[model samples]
Target: MKLGPIDWAIMATYFVFVLGIGFALRRYMKTTTDFFQSGRSIPAWVAGLAFISANLGAQEVMGMAASGAKYGIMTSHFYWIGAIPAMVFLAVFMMPFYYGSRARSVPEYLKLRFDEKTRGLNAITFALMTVLSSGISMYAMGLLLNLLLGWSFDVSIWLCALIVLLYITMGGLTSAIYNEVLQFFMIVFGFLPLVLLGLHDVGGWAGLKTGLEHVAVSNGFAAGAWSQSWAHMGSPTDNPMGVEWFGMAMGLGFVLSFGYWCTDFLTIQRAMASESMSAARRAPLIAAFPKMMFPFLVILPGMLAIVLHQRLGAGGFSLPTKADGTLNYDMTVPLMLSHYFPQGMLGVGITALIASFMAGMAGNVTAFNTVFTYDIYQAYIRKGAPDAHYLWVGRVATVAGISASVAAAYLATHFNNIMDMLQLVFAFVNAPLFATFLLGMFWKRTTGHAAFIGLISGTVGAAIHHGLTLPLGSVPGIKGGWLGLTHQYTSEMAQNFWTAIWAWSTCFVVTILVSLVTKARAEAELKGLVYSLTERLKSDAEAWWRRPAVLGVIVLALTLVLNIVFL
Candidate 1:
C-alpha cells in the first residue's frame, strides 16, 4: 500500500480545495437561518446530490462492498428494497407537510402535529443518535487511515475531528451541504473506474458470476449466491441474508426504509434547505437516479475482490482476517484499492474515501447542532432568544457535538463492525419513528398522548424482540444480550428486519387504541399538518417531468426493472 510522491501531491490538492470551499463560504453565515437552514436558498440539483451524499459514507461504500462479498448480488436489496421506495414516498406523498409546515426540524413537526412531549422525546433521541453516528464516522475514518496509511488511530481521529469542526463551524450547514455535493462527484469519479477495471480483469459480469458460484461451492454456500436476489429468499434458512420475503417487504421495505429516508433528520435537512417547495420535493426524486446506480459502482468492487482473492490466493492478495479466520468485512474496499489501483488513481480513491467519511461526519454534526440549538435550547432552555444569540449557540454546539463524537469514536473501537453497530442503533432509535410520523400525518384522530406513548412502547418492543429472538454469538462484532429464547435468529440482518416489524406493529396498535380513548387536537390547529386537513396544491406551473409525483412514478418503475433484471 505504499504511495508515490505524485499520490501524496494529489491527496494534498484535494484537501486544499475542500478547506478553501469552507473558508470561502464563511461569509454566508450571517444569521441563524443561514447557518442552520442555508437561508432556504440552495437549488434543487445541488440539494439533491447532497441528499444522497449524506448517506454515502464509509458505512455505504465499505459496508456494502463487504455485504457483496459475503451475500452476493442480493446485497442490492439494501438499495432497491431498502431505500428507493421510501425515498419516492417521501418525495411524492410526504414532502408537503415537511416543507410546507414551516417547521425547523422533524421534531418541530411533531410539536406542531402532536404535542411537546412527543417532540421532546424525538428531539433528545435524535440529538444523541446523530452525535453517536458522527462518532461512528470518525472511528471509521481513523480505522481506514490507520489501515491504509499506517497512521496511529488517535492521530487519524483527531485529524478528522479537527477538519470537520473547522469547516462545519465556519460555514455551518451550507458549507457541509456544498462539500457533500463535491464529495459525491469525487466518489463517482474515483470508484467508477475501479469497478470498470475490476470487471475487465475478472472477464466481465458473466465471468464474475461464475467465479462467485465457484467460491460459494468452496465455502459451502448455495451455487446461485452470486446472481440471484429473491429466488432464494423463500425461507430464513435458504440464503445468507437469513430473511424471508414477508420480513423483507414489510419490515425493511416499508418500515425501515420509510423510517430512515423520510424521517431521519440527517438527510431530511438537506432537502429542507432547498429554495422552494417544489425543489424540496424534487430533491429526493433527483437523488434517486444516482442512488439506483450505486450498487454497480460500490457493490461490484467487493464481488471483484472475491474473484481476485480466489484467483491470486492469500499470498498474492490478502483480506483482513481475525485470529479465528473470520473476515473483517469492512476491509473489502481498502483491500481492493491496494490490489488493483495505481498511484494517481490510488490517491483519488483514498481521497474519495476520506471525503465520504468527512461528509458523513459533517452531516451528522450539522444536524445535531441544529436539533440541539433550535429544537432543545431555544425551544426550552432559552426561549425568545435573539437570532444572533441562537446563531452563536449553534456555532458553540458544533464544537461540542464534534467533541462528543470524538469520545464516541474511542468507544466504537471495541466493536467488530461499524455497519452492524449502526443497524443496531437504527433498530433502537429509528424503527418506531416512522410509525409515529405515519399516524400523525394520515390519521387526524391520533391524539398527542397516544403518539408519545406509542413511540416509547414501540422502542421498548424493539429492544425486547432483539433480546428474546436474536441469538447469542450470531453477529461477529456485537455482544449478545440476555433473554435468550429457544428460537434464535440466523443472522443480524434478519434480526434488524424483524425488529422493525415488531416495533412498527407495537407503535401502530398502541397509537390507534390510545387515540380512541384520548381527545384529539382541533381540526383548525391541524390544518397543513395532517393529510385530510391540508389543502391539495397543484403543480401545473412546473413541467410534467419535473413534478414530484411524475418523477416518483418513473423512479419506481425503473427501480422495479432493476430488481427484475437482477433477479
Candidate 2:
C-alpha cells in the first residue's frame, strides 16, 4: 500500500521540525557539558521521557511485536520482568553512588574505584559495543523501512542517521533529550492507537482470548524449564528455552533487565543528565513505571496480531517468510498492521515505529558523544582541555559515530533480520558487562585486574560460541588473516542467548574467583564503590530513597501480581 500524501507530508513536517530544534539548540551548547550532558540541567520529566525514548529502538518494536504475536501477554516480561526491576534498583540502590561520587561515566567510576588501566580497557570495550549496538539499532530501522515501504535500505539508513546526527551534533545531549521528550509522546500517540485499533479489529478481549486459546500455547504460565534444545538453537515453534516458563522468565529478568537498564550508557545518561542527585534517582524510577507498561504499546499489538492471524487460519503469521510461501516471524507485526489496520491507524502506526527508531538513535548518538568526549579525548588526548575543545570533539565524534552506524546498518542487510541480529548483539556485549557492573559495584574486593580479565574472557568466550559458527573474523583484513579464522556460524538469536548466558556466568565466576586471590583496593579509595548508607549520611540517603523506594516496592508488587494474573 502506498503511503498517502497526507502521511508523507506529516512525516516530512515532523522531520523538518526536529532538525530545526537541533539547530536552534546549537548556540546553547557552548561547553562540553552542554554538548554531551545538557550542562546537567535537564528537569526530571524531560529526563524521564528521554530515558524511556532511548530504550525504544526499532528492534524493540519488532521483538515485542514478534513475541506478542507468538507469546500472548507473556512477552511483556521483557520489560516488566527485566527493565522495571533494574530501573528501580538503579534509582534506589545505585544512583546515589554514581551521582554522589561525581563520576562522569561508568568507566570513570571504575578508574576512581579501581584503576586507570581498568577504566581505559572498559572505555574501549564499551565504545566498541556501543558502536555495534547503535549500528544494529540503526540497521533495524532501515531494514524495517525497506521491507515495509520498499525504500532502499542504505538510503533509509542514511536518511535516518543524518537526521539524528544533525540534531545530536548541533544541540548535543540537550537537543537529543528535548527531541526525545517529543519523540516519546510521538511513539505513544502513534503506536498505542494502532494497538487499540488492532484490538477492535480482533473483536475485543473475548476475541483475543479465543484466538490465543486456539494457538499452540494457551497459557505461558505452567512451570517447567525452557527446553535446552530450543533454548540453544532458538526455534520459532518454542520459547527460547522451552525451559520452565517461570525460571526462564526470572532468569532472563535477572540478566537482561539489569544488564541493559543499569549498565547501558543510553539509559544511564538520562539519569546522569538530571539537575540534581535526587532528580537523577527519581527520574529513572519514574521511567520504570512506563517501561513496565510499554509492552502494552509495543508487544501487546504483536500478540493481538498473532491471535487474529491464527483465527483467520493464517499460517506463518509469526514466522519468517521467503519468496515461496513461508513464514518470517519478524514480519508478523508489520504484516498484521498492513492487513488489519485502517488507513489512518496504519499511518499512525508507521509513524510510531519511526518514532521508536528516532528516539533510540538519538539516545545512542548522545551517549556515544558523551563517552567519546569524556572517556577518550578528555581522559587521554587532551587532559585538562577547556570545555570548548571537548565540545568540538563531541560534535565531530557524533558525525563519525553516525557515519559508522549507517555503514553498520548497511552491513546488517546481510544478517537474517532485525530481531535475530539484536539478540545476538545483546548476548555477547551486554551480558558480560552486566555481570561486571554488578560485581564491580557490590563487591569491593573485585579487583581492576579481575574486571579486565572477566570482561575479556566473557566477550571472547561469547564471541567464540557464536563466531565459531561464522567467519566474522575471516574478513580479508590484517586482523582476520592474523587470527587465521574462517566464518563458520550462521547467526541465530537462541544460539546467541545461550552463548550470552554462558558468557555472563563465566565472567561472574571468574571475577569472584580472581577477586578471592587478588588484593582489594584500599578502603579509602573504594568508598565510592560500595553503598555507604550509614547514619552519618542517613538524612541525605533517606530523602533520596523515600519516593524511589516506594516506587520500587510498588513495581515489585505489580510484577508479582502480573505473574499471577497474566502469565
For all predicted structures, in order, the TM-scores are 0.96, 0.85
- Worst window of 10 by summed lDDT in candidate 1: 471-480
Error of 1 at 94 (Å): 0.9
Question: TM-score for model 2?
Answer: 0.85
lDDT digits (tens) for residues 1-567 of candidate 2: 568877787787778778999989988988777777788898877888888888777677788777666455656656776577788888877887777776888777777766777788777767766776778787777767887899987787877887887888888888888888888877788777667877787678776666666654444522211111112223332443233343344346676667777877778888888998767878887787787778778876776766665655543334445677644468766776676656666676677678778778777777777787788878888898777777778888998888877766666767645535454554566678778888887777788888888877887777665554432223423211223343332223333344567678878998899889998777777665675421123334455344667767887788667655554
lDDT of 1 by residue, 1-567 (tens): 888898889888988887888899899899999999999999999999999999998778999999888888888988999999999999888889999997989999999999899999999989988888888888878877887899899998898889889999888899999999989999999888888888888889888989888877777768886668888888877777778888889988998899999999899999999999999999999999999999999998888887777787532565677888987677888888877789989999988998899899999999999999989998899999789999999999999999999988887887646646664755676789898899989999999999999998898888788777754356422533446664577777777788889898999999999999999988999999999999987998889998998999999999999999988
> What lDDT score belongs to each candidate, Candidate 1 first?
0.87, 0.70
lDDT of 2 at 88: 84
- Backbone clash tally for model 1? 0
Query: How much is 387 displaced in model 2, in angstroms?
Result: 1.8
Off by over 4 Å in 1: 313-316, 414-426, 472-481
